[model samples]
Target: AQSVTQPDIHITVSEGASLELRCNYSYGATPYLFWYVQSPGQGLQLLLKYFSGDTLVQGIKGFEAEFKRSQSSFNLRKPSVHWSDAAEYFCAVGVRRDDKIIFGKGTRLHILP
Candidate 1:
């Protein structure tokens, strides 16, 4: 089975500061990684995903993630975060598109003024 872990349960960043959220996965083979954001009372929104091709993938809302095979990590980063970026971030891993995706516990992002 595949699993994902988000080390940080909560993260706080200034309104315009850079942000990085750690994500690690445990899988025997190359697995698909996805980053999703959920605002308060909102549904999950796909931020970025890593399946194949480039290791570094860009996502919506000025977010990007780098897939490190050796480290089994797919960390998400943003140059400058906005107040609206505050939400719950999730890391998911799956073997195939049709397979069930396993999500992390989720990390709550806090925006500080």
Candidate 2:
């Protein structure tokens, strides 16, 4: 079974400020982890993915995430955020072999000027 947990329901950050969103997952020994962002009424956009190799992976929009196997966590980070970056973020885990995908509850981001 694959599962993800996003503890933060909402997060507020000022424009140009740094942002970090936490994610934890429970899955097989080696699971495919991904981070996605979605705007209101829009579909989810892939932010980053961790399949193998690098523990730290970079994504679009100045965002990055590090996979910590010990903590079972993959936290997203941005050095500086823009107003347009405000959106709902979700953490997901997938099994390529089974074509199964599991998503988190999601965390809505609010930009405060």
Candidate 3:
């Protein structure tokens, strides 16, 4: 069985500050990893993924993550934050041969100007 856990349920950051969200997964084999961001009343958009090479992967909206095999972690990071970036972020694991993906409960990010 494969599963993902997001430690932080919610986070608040000031504008132009750095941000990081934690993620941990349990899988028998190397699984397809993904991070998605969803705005209120909107569908989820893929931020990034880790399927093969390069432990460090970059994604849209100036976001990046590092895949740590030993720690079973893939944490999201951004140098500076923006007010518009406020949204709910979800971490997901794609199981091989499985059409569906499992998503974390999500972390609601609040931005303060």
Best by TM-score: 3
> What are the per-residue Cα lDDT tens digits for candidate 3 across 31-102?
789999999999999999999999999999999999999999999999999999999999999988776688
Clash pairs of candidate 1? none
What TM-score would every model get versus the actual structure? 0.96, 0.96, 0.97
- The lDDT for every candidate, in the order shown, is 0.94, 0.94, 0.94
Candidate 2 Cα RMSD after full superposition onto the native fold (Å)? 0.8
Give the distance in Å from residue 78's predicted Cα in candidate 1 to where it truly belongs: 0.2
Clash-forming residue pairs, model 3:
none
Report the lDDT of model 2 for residue 40: 94
Note the clash tally of each candidate: 0, 0, 0
Per-residue lDDT for 8-79 in model 1, tens only? 999999999999999999988888999999999999999999889999999999999999999999999999
Model 3 TM-score is: 0.97
Pairs of residues at least 3 apart in sequence or in different chains that clash in candidate 2: none
